[model samples]
Target: MGKATGFMEYQRLQEASEAPQSRKKHYKEFVMHLDDAQAKTQAARCMDCGIPFCNNGCPVNNIIPDWNDLVYNGKLREALDTLHSTNNFPEFTGRICPAPCEAACTLGIIKDAVGIKSIEHYIIDKGWENGWVTPQPAAVSTGKKVAVVGSGPAGLAAAQQLARAGHAVTVFEKNDRAGGLLRYGIPDFKLDKNLIDQRVKQMEGEGVVFRTGVLVGKDFPAGITNWAKETVSPETLQKEFDAVIIAGGAETPRDLPVPGRELKGVHFAMEFLPQQNKVNAGDKVKDQISAAGKHVVVIGGGDTGSDCVGTSNRHGAKAVTQFELLPQPPEQENKPLVWPYWPTKLRTSSSHEEGCERDWSVATKRLEGSKGKVEKLIACRVEWKDGRMQEVPDSEFEVKADLVLLAMGFVSPVQPVLDAFGVDRDARGNARATTDGAGCYKTNADKVFAAGDMRRGQSLVVWAIREGRQCAREVDAFLMGESVLPR
Candidate 1:
C-alpha cells in the first residue's frame, strides 16, 4: 500500500523521548511525535502484503495501509480522515494504545513493524494544527434521544456516533470531567489532558451533551463521592430517552486480603492515580497520596502497576518495587509460532525505564505494619507447576514499605449500578450483552443496552472504542429501523 521498495530501504524508528531523569521531574508528556520527514519515511515502511493482518489485528480495524499510503504521499489531511473513519480519538490511542496493529504488520514477519501509531500521532496533531478537525453536526434531527452512562472512551465514541446520526445524545459521567480514565486514571506524562478537552469540545459542537458529575446509578462504593456530586437513577434515563447505553467502566478493583490490609498507607491503584490527576488539574485534593521519600511497593505487573511505578518515581519515592504473580515471559517472542497474533513477550514500558525493582512469580503473603499503619510487606516466591502456583519453601521474605499500592486490576462494574438498571450480569459479573446477532448490545431490560468494559470486562482502550462504535450502530438501528453508522 506504500512504496514497493520502501520496506527494504527503511528501518522502524521510534518516537523520541526525553531522558528519564529529566522527565521524572514532572508529569507533562515527554514523548515527541514524528516530524514530517520522519513520519513519511515511517509510513513508507508499509508493504503491499497479500493480506494485511494488521487490519484485523487492530480492535477498531483501522485502515492502516490506506493511511500509510496517504502519509507517504504527503497527503496528511487524507490520512487524518482515514484514521478518524474508524477511531473517534486517535489522539488517545496514538499515545496510549499498545498498537497490536504494529505487532501484526507484514514487515514484522521479517523485520520491524511500521510505525503506525507514531504516524497517527503526526496526522492527528497536524490536522489539529491546520484547524481541520472540526465538528460534523447532523443536518436533520431524528428526534430520538440516547442517554449514555459514562464518559470514558467507549461512552464518548458511542455518543459522538449517535449525535452524528441525528439523535440527541447525552453523556452522563460520575466525575466532574468528560474523559473518565483518560482524565483521571492515566498519568499526565503519558497523555496530556488537553487532547481530551479538544475532543470533548468537538463533540459538544457536534451536538453531544455531556453532563459531568452526574452519577447514573446509586450505592456507589466508598471514595466515589469525591468524583460524583449528584445521582440520576436508571429509571430517569429510561423514561427520558428513547434508548439507553450503559458504558460505565469496570470500577470494582480486585483486593489483596492479606493481614494488615486495613492499615493506613495501603490503597488501591485507582485511589492513588485519580488524586494525583485531580491535583494536576488544579483541583484541591485533601489527603492526597504521595510516594515522595517513602518506600513504595506496587503489586501487580500490568499497565496499572507500571503506571504506579511511573507515578511513584515522579513523586520522588525513596524506592519503587513492583511484583508480578506470573513468571516472566521471554524477552523476545517466537514470532514464527504466533505470527499475526499478540505474542506473549517481555514488555518494558517507559515507566519501567524511569526506575523500578521488578520481580516475577512472587505472591504477597501479608502486610506487616506498626500501630494501624503499614510498615512492611511479607511475600514469598512461587513456581508454576501444571498451571498451579506452588510456593517455594523457605522463600518467604519481608521488605520495608511506607506505602503499598495495589494495581492488581479491576474485577467488574459496580454491581449496584447495574442492579439499578435491572440488567442481568454474566458469570464474570459483566453486564449480559451480546456484541452480535439480531439484537446486539441489547440487555435484559427493554430499551437498554451495554458496551465496553462494563459488558466485556477490563480491556484496552482500543477494544472499548470498538465496542462503543459497534454498540452505537445497534442502538441506531433499533431506534431508526436501520443504521448508517459503521460497525
Candidate 2:
C-alpha cells in the first residue's frame, strides 16, 4: 500500500549500531536511527498484499500498510495517527518487539520484508519531536473506579484505556516506581528509561493515577510494607473500586536445582539485571555484582540470557558463555511451511552480536565450588531422539565459572497476590482467564479480572499490551454496561 512497485525497487534498510568495542564500554543505547528521507524510503518497501498477514501478526494489529503509504506519500502526521490508532506504545514495541509483522510481510516470501519496526520507531520519534503526541482526556466522566495491580506495559495500557473511557483508574506498583520490568528488568542500552518516564508523564496528563510502592493483598507482609511506600489489601480495593484488574507480571523465576546451587556467586537473572538498571538510574548500589575480571556463565538461552551476556561484556568480564538445553535451530526457516506464523529458527539478538560464546543441546549437570562460592560447572552434551533427550557417553566436561546467572524464565505471578484475591490458576501456573468475548478477562472471584503475563504466562511486551487493552475494554463494559474502547 505504500507504492505500486516500490517493493520491487527498494531493499529493506535498518538503523545502524555502534561497534561492539565502543558500545561495550558503557550501558547506553548505541543504535543510530535513519534520517527522515531514509525512513520514508524504507516505508516505501511496504507492498499492497491482497490480504495483509502483517496485521494479523502484529499483537495490537497496527495498520502497517496504511501508515507505510502515509509515510511514503510524505504525510507524516496522518501516519503517526494511523500508527497510534491501534498501538499505544509504538516506541516500546519498535525497540523491543521481535517484529512478527516483518516475518509475515508479503514480500518476505522471496525478498526481505519491509523495515516495519524501524519505520515505527521513526514515526513515533518524529511525532514526539513535532509535538503531535498529546493527552486525549475523555470528554465525559463515568464516575466508576478501576484498580490495576501492576505497572508493567499491560497494566499501564489497561489503566490508560480505562481512564480514557471516563473511568477513574489507579495503578498500584510494588516497586519503588512504576514500569515494573521496563523500569528494572530490561537493560537501558536496549530501551532508555527516559522513554518510559515520558509516557508516564503523558498518562498522568491524561488523568491516570500512579501509586508506586503499593502492594495489594491480605495481611500485607511487614517486609513488603517496608519495601513499598504505601499498602492496600485486595478487600480494601474491592470495597473502594467498582472493578479490579490484576495485571501484575509473572514474578516467580524458574530456578536451576543442582549441586552447589546455594553458592554465593550464583544469582537469578532478575537479581543481576535490575541492579545495573537501578545504577544507571542514579541509584547507589554497594559492591554491585561485577562480571568484571571474572568468568561468567549464563544459563538459559533466551532474551534474559542475552541480556546477561550484554551486561557481562559491559562489565568487562574475562569471558562469557551462554548455555541452552535445546538443540540449535536451523539458521534459516523453510518459508513455504512457516509463512505467516512464528517459526522455530535461530534468532540472534543485538546482545548476542555484542560478544559471547553460545552453546545448545547441552545441560548443566552440577555446579562445583570452593568457599561456598561457584567455581566451575559440570556439564554434558545431550542428543534428542524419539522426543527425548539422552546424554552422550563420555561427554561430561567441566568449565571454570566465577559467576553464574540463571535466566530460565518465570513460573508464574507471585502466589500470595493470587491467593489473596482467590483467583484460580491454570495448570501452567498462570491466572485462569480467557481473552475471548463473554466474561473476557474475568477472574473466578466477583468484581475481579486478570491480564498480561499473570494470565498468559511469559510473553512479549506487545502481547502483554494487547491483553491489557482488551481486558480494560471488558472491565469498562462490565462497569458501564458498554464500552467504546478498542480491544
Candidate 3:
C-alpha cells in the first residue's frame, strides 16, 4: 500500500460538479473528474485490505488495489495500463457504471468507500490527455476472421480483443453509428458521443473494422431503433467469419400494456432517448418526441427512467414525475449484514437532484385521453405482502400528463435477430448461451457465440464488457484450439 494509515489521515473527496440550475441549461457533462492531488489522496485510502472483494465485485474483475497504489504513487501510465488490462473501455464504465466494487470495498464496512470510480475516471482521462492510450495491434496475424453483431460495449470489447489477438474482426451495427446504446441510449450530458468516436478510431487503428448502418439480421420490428440501409444475412456471416459473437443489447423494452397503450404521446424510453441523442449529434428527426412544455410522467425507477427525467428537464417540461411499482428501499444499508455484496437501497440519480417528483408503491391503471393523445395517467397506490402486491382501497388517482415515457427496462434481445441466426433462445428470449464449460458462450448454431445482454438479458455495461472479453477468449480458443487472450 502507498500509505498504510492514509485512511485515518485523509477523508473522501467527491468530484466537483456543475450546479443544477446552470447545468440544466445545456447538454454537457456536469461531473468533473478529480485532479491529480485529489485522486492521489483518494487512492491512498485503499487501506491495504487483505481480500480485495472490490475486484470480484467489479464485473470485469479490475485489479483495484494495484491501480490504487499506482495512482497513489503518481504512476499515472501504469495505473492506466492496469485499468485497460481488465476493462477495454474504462471511460464508459467510469462515467456510467454504478460501481458495485465500491459497495464491496472492505473499508466501506466502516467509513466511506475509497473513491475508486473517481480514480479510474482520472486515470483514463489523464491517459488520453498524455496520449498513453493507443492502438495495440498484435505482432502476428492469426489469419482468422471474426464477426461481432452489435457495436455496443460487449461487441466493441469482443472485437478489440479478437483483433488484438491478430484475428481480423468486423463489427456490424444496425444504427448509423457504431456505439449501439452507448452513443444513442445514454444522454449526451452523461457521456459525450466523441468518446465513442475516439475509441472507434483507436480500435480501427488496432485492425478492428466497424460497419455502421449494417444490420446482421434480415429485419427488425418497426420502432426498434434500426437505422440500417443495408442488411446482411446471418448465413453470409457464418460463411465468411471463423466465429460470430452476438453481443447486441436487450432491445425489447418491457411494455406497460394498459388499455390506452395505443394512445399517442406515450412512448417507450428507447424511442424517446435515441431521438434526443440523434438531435444532439446534429441530426434532424421528424416528429421527435419532446417533453417541452408538457407535464411529463416517467414510469419505472431505473437508470432509464432517471434519464427520462433529466432529458425532460432539459426539454423544459412544465413538470416531471417518476413512478416506481416497487416499494422504496432503505436510504442506508446495514453494512454488517451485507458487506462485500450489493445491497438494495434507495438511489437518487443526478437527474433526480436536478428536479423530479418521485413516488413508490404505485402502479398505473390506465391512460386517459381524447383524440388518440394521452392526457392523464390513472394509477393506484399499493401495498406488498409476501412478494405479492395489492392495491390500497380508494387509493386511485389521476395526474395530468401530456407526455408519458415508459422506462421499465428491457426484457430481452430483439427476437428477430436470434431467429435470423437460427439460435436457441432462453425463456426470456435472450440468445441461449452459457458463460462456462468447454462449449461456453457458444450457441447450438455452428460457429455462433453470444455474450453480454444478448445472452444475459438486461444488464450493466461492465457485465457486457466482461462477457465480451471472456467470449473473445472462447472464440479465440475455438478458432486455434488454444488461446493466450485473457479470460
Candidate 4:
C-alpha cells in the first residue's frame, strides 16, 4: 500500500462526464479522465487488504494493488507494465468494463470503493501519450501457422499472443473492418473507432495479419449480418493453418416473437446500431433506419437497450421509452450479504441520464401497426410469484411507437460458422469445449479450438480477452508439445 491511511483520508472521485444535453448532440466520448495528481490520489486509496478480492473480481485477474502502489509512487511506466502483465488490452476495458473489481474492493465494505477504473484509464492513456505502447515482435520463428476466426477482442488477443509466440497468425473478420462488436455493435460515443485502429496497426507490426471482409464459412444465409465481400471455405483454413481458433462471438440475437413482429420499422439492435457506427466512420448507407422525429420504443433494459436510447436521443427523437420484463432491482445492494462479489442493483447508464422513460415488470403483448409499419405497442403489467409470471388483470396499455428496437441480448454464436468447422455445440448453442485439464479450449474437432463468446456464450470483453489468452496457450502447447505463454 502506498499510503496506509489513504483510504481514510480520501473520498472517491469519479471521472467527470459531459452534460447530457450537450453530449447527446454528437456521437463522441463525453467522459473526461482524471489528471495525474487526482489519479495518484485515487490509486493511493487502495487498502492493504490481505486477500485482494479485486484480483479475483476482475475477469482478467489484473494485479490491482501493485499497479495502484506504482501509480501512487509516480512510477508510471512500472504501473503500465504491471497492468499489461495480466490484461492484453487495458484501453478497451478501462473505457467499457463495468468495473466489478471496484465492487469487490475491500474499502467498499465501509466507504466508497477505490476508483480503480479511472486510474487504469489514466495509466493507459498516459502510456499511449508517452509512446510507451509498441510492437513486441517474436524473437524467433516457430515455423507454424494459426488461423483466428473473428476480429473481436478474443480473436485479436489470441492472434497477438500466438504471433508473439513465434507463429504466423491471420485473423479473419466477416465485417469490412477489423473490430467485431467494438467496431460496429457499440456506439462511437463510448469508444472511438480510432482506438481499435491504433491497436490493429500495432498488431500488424507484431507480425499478425488481418483479413477484413473475409467470411470463413459457406452456405451464408440472407438477413444474417454478414459484411463479407469474399468467402473462404473452412476446408481452406484447416489445410493452410496448423491450428484454427473460433472466436467469432455470440451473434445470434434473441428475438421478440410476439404478434406483429414482422412489421416494418421494427428491427434488431444490431441492425440499427451498426448503421450508426458505419455512418460515424464516414461510410454511406442506403435506406438507413433513422430514429429522427419518431416515437421510439426500445425493448429489453440492458446495455444494448441503453445504447438505443442514447442513439435515439442523438437522432432527435420525439420520445424514447425503454421496457424491461423483469422487476426493478433495489437502488442499493446489501453489502453485508454480497460483499467481494458483483452486487445486483439498479444501474442507470449515461444514456438514461440523457433522457429515457424506463419501466419494469411490463411485457409486450403485440405490436400494432398501420400499413405494415409499426405504430404502437400493446403491453401489460405482470407479477412474478413462485417463479411464474401472470399478467395483472385490467393492466393492459398501449404506447405510441413509430420505431421499435429489440435489444434483448444475444442467444448464441452464429451457428453457420460452428457448423462449417464441424464443431460440437453446447445446449446453449455455443461451441462445446472444456476449459480445464489436458484438453482445455480444444474442441471435439481435431486441430480446432474455441474460446470467448463463441464457447462461453455472450459475455464481457474482459472475459473474452482472458479466454483468448488462455486459449492461445493451449493452442501453442498443442502445436509445440509445450508453451511458455501464461494461462
Candidate 5:
C-alpha cells in the first residue's frame, strides 16, 4: 500500500474518451490513457486487503497490488515488469478486456475500484516508448521443434514461451496477417492494427517463425473467413515437429435458424466484421457488406453486437437497433452479496453511447422480405419464469431492417481442423483436453496438445494467454521430460 489514506483522499478518475459524435467519424482508437501523475494517484488507491481478490479475479492472475504499489511509487519499469510477468499481452487486455478485477476489488464494495486497466495501459505504453520492450532471444538452442496452429493470442503466447525456452517454434495462421481476432474481428476504433504488427516484429526477432496465409487442415467452408494462399496437412506437422499445439479458437458462430434466414441481407457478425477490418488495412473487398443508409438490426447483446453498432454508425446508417433475448440486468449490482466476484450488471459500451436503440427480452420470429433481400423483422416479447421462456400474447411487432447482423457469439471450434488431426472433441465440440493432471493439455492423439479457445471454447483474450502459457509448459515437459518454463 503506497498510500494508506489514498482511497479516502481521492475519487476515482476514469480515462477520458473522445466524444462519440467526433470519434465515430474515423476508425481509430479514441480513449486516451491517463498521464503519469494521474496514473500514480489511481494506483495509490489499492488497499491493504489481506487477500487480493483482484488477482484471482483476473484470468491470468496478474499481481495487481504489487504492480499498483510499484506504479504508485513511480517505479515505471518495475511496474511494467510485474505486468509482463503474468500477461504476455497486457496491451490487448488493457484495451479490450472487461475488468473483472475491478469488480472484485475491495474498494469497489464501498467506493470506486482502482483504475487498474488504465494504469496497465499507461505502463505498457510507457514501456514501449522508452524502448524497454525488446526480443529476449534464448541463450542456447534446443534441437526440438514445436508447431503452433492459429496465430491468435494463445498461439502467439505459446510460441513466444517455447522459443524463449530454446525450442524452435513456428506459428501457422490461415489469415494473411498474424493476429487472429485482434487483427480482424475487433474494429480498428478500439485497437490499432499497428500494435499487433509491432509485437509480430518482436516475436520474429526472438527466433519464432510466423507462416501467414498457411492453412493446416481441409479447406474452410465458403463464406467463412479465410485468407490462406497455401495449405499444410496435419500429418506433415505431426511428422515434422516434436509436438503440435492447436489454438485455432472457436470459429463456428451460433446461427438463428428462423424463417428467411437465407435472405441475402442477413449475415453473421464475423462475416461483416472482418470485411471492414480488411478495408481499414487497405485491402479492396468485392461486394463488401455495407450498412450505409440502411436500418440495421444487430441481434445478440454482447461485445460483438456492440461492435456492430459502432461500425454501423461509422458507416452512416439510417438507424441502429440492438436486440437481446435475455432480460436486462440491473444497472447497479448488489455489492454486499457479490463482493470479490464478478456480478451480473448492465454494461453500456461506447458504441451504445454513440447511438443505438437497445431492447431486451425480445426474440425474433421471422424476417419478411421480397426478391431474396430482407426488408423487415418480426419479433415478440418474452417472459422468463423458472428458467424457461414463454412468448407474450399479443406482443408481436414488426420493424424495418435492411441489414441484419447476427452477433450471438460462437458455439465451438471449426470441426474440420479437429477432424483433420483426429483429435477427440468434448461434448461442446471443443477439443477435449484437461487443464490439470499429468496429461494436462495433451489430446487423445499422440504428440498433440490443445489450448485456449480451441479447448476451452470461445473466451477472453486473457484466458487465451493463460492457457497458452500453461500449455507451453506442458509441451516443454513432454519434450524434455521436465520443464523450467513458468506455469
Candidate 6:
C-alpha cells in the first residue's frame, strides 16, 4: 500500500472532464488526466488493507496495492510491469472499465475510493511515453503453433501470451483490421484507434501474425467447421494451427419484436455506432446514419444506450431520450451489505452526463411510423411486482423519434461460427467451456478452446483479457505437457 497515514491525509482526486457543452461539439476524448504530482497524491490514498479486495474486484485481478505503493514511492516502471503482468491491455481497461476495484476499495466505505483507474491510466501512459513498453519476444521458439480467432482484447491477450510462451501464434480477424470490437464497437471518443494500432504494432514485433479481412470459412479453405460466414473454416484452422482458441465476441443483438420494428429509421446500436467509428478512422461510409437535425430516441438503458445518447449529441440531434424498462436504482448503495461485490445502484456514464432525458420504469409498446420509417416511439410507464413488469394505467406517452437505436445488449455469440466449428454451447448460447482447474477453456471440439465474450457472453474488456490469458495457459498445457504461463 501507500503511506500508513496516507488514506486519512490525502483525499481522492479525479481527472476533470470537459464540460458537456464543449464536449458535445466533437467526437474526441474530453477527459483530462492528472499530472504526475496529482496522480502520486491520489496513489498515496491507497491504505494498507490487511487483505486488499480491489484485486478481487478487478476482473483481471491486477496487482492493485503493489502498483499503488510503487507509484507512491515513485517506482513507475515497476508499477507498469506489475500492471502488465496481470493485464495485457491496461490502457483499454483504464479508459472504459467501470472500475469495480474502486467500489471495493476499503477507504471507499467512508470516503471516495483510491483513484485506482486513474493511477492505472497514469502508469500505462507514462510507460508508453518513456518507451518502457517494448516487445520481449521469447528467446527460443517451442515450435508449437496456435491460432486465435477474433482479434479483440481477449484474442490479442491470448495470442500474446502464447507467443511469449515460445509458440508461433497467428490471430485471424474477419474485420478489415485487428482489435475486433475494440476497433469497431467502442467509440473513438472513449478509446482512440491509434492506441489499438500502437499495441497491434507491438504484438506484430513480438512475432504474433495477424491476418485481417481473410474470412476463415469463406476466404480460407474449409478447415475445422465451415460455419464461419465471413472468415476461415474451423477445419482449415485446425489443419494449419496446432491449437485453436475461439475468442470472437457476442455478435447477435437482442431484438425487440414489435409492430413497425422493421422501420427504416430503427437500427441496432451496433449498426449506428460502428459507422461513426469507421468514419472517425477515415473510412468512406456512404449514407451514414446521422441523428443530425432529427429527434433521436435510444431504447434500453445500458452502456450501449448511453453510448447512443453521446453519439446522438455529437450528431446534433434535435432531442435525445433514453428509455429503460427496469425501475430506477438508488443513487447510492448500502456499502455494509454489498461490500466487495458489484452493487446494483444507479450508475451514470459520462455519456449520460453529456445531455439526454433518461427515464426508467418504462416500456416500449410500439414504434409509430410513416413512410416505413419510425416517426415516434409509443411507450408507457411500468411497475414491477413478483419478478414481472406491468404497465401503469393511463401512462402511455409518445415521443418524437426520427431515429431509434436499440441498445438492449447482446443475447449471445453468433451461432454460425460456433456451429461451423461444431463446438457445444451452454444454455446462455455461449460456447460451452469451464474455467475450473480441470477443463478450463476446453471446447467439446478437439484441440479447440473458447474465451472472451463468445465463451462468457457479453462482458467487460478486463474479463475478456483475463479469460484470454487464462485460456492461453490451458491451450499451452494441452499442447505441451504443462505450461509455464500463469493462469
Angstrom error at residue 456, model 3: 0.4
Worst 10 residues of 3 by lDDT: 215-224
Q: Enumerate clash totals for all models, in the order shown.
A: 0, 1, 0, 0, 0, 17
- lDDT values for all models: 0.92, 0.89, 0.94, 0.93, 0.94, 0.88
**Per-residue lDDT of 221 in model 4:** 51
How many steric clashes does model 4 contain? 0
Q: Give the TM-score of candidate 2.
A: 0.97
TM-score of 3: 0.99
Could you tell me which 10 consecutive residues in candidate 6 have the lowest summed lDDT? Answer: 220-229
Ranking by lDDT: 3, 5, 4, 1, 2, 6
Tens digits of per-residue lDDT for model 3 on 37-120?
999999999998899999999999999999999999999999999999999999999999999999999899889999899999
TM-score of each: 0.99, 0.97, 0.99, 0.99, 0.99, 0.97
RMSD of each: 0.9, 1.8, 0.7, 0.8, 0.8, 2.9
User: What is the per-residue lDDT of model 2 for residues 1-487, given as tens digits with 9 covering 90 to 100?
Assistant: 6578889988888698899888999888887667888987898888878898999999999999999899988999999999988998988998999999988998899998889999999899899899998888889999999999999999999998998998899999888878988778889999998989989999998899999878787433221111476678899999999999999877778888898898888888888888888789898977788899999999999999999999999999999999999999999998999998987899998878888899999999999998888999999999999999999999999889999999988887777889999999999888898888699999998799999998999899999999999999999899978888988
| Tens digit of per-residue lDDT, candidate 5, span 220-272 | 76556899999999999999999999999788999999999999899999999
CA deviation > 4 Å runs, candidate 4: 219-224
- Global CA lDDT computed for model 5: 0.94
- What are the runs in model 2 whose C-alpha is more than 4 Å off? 218-227
Model 4: residue 408 alpha-carbon error in angstroms? 0.6
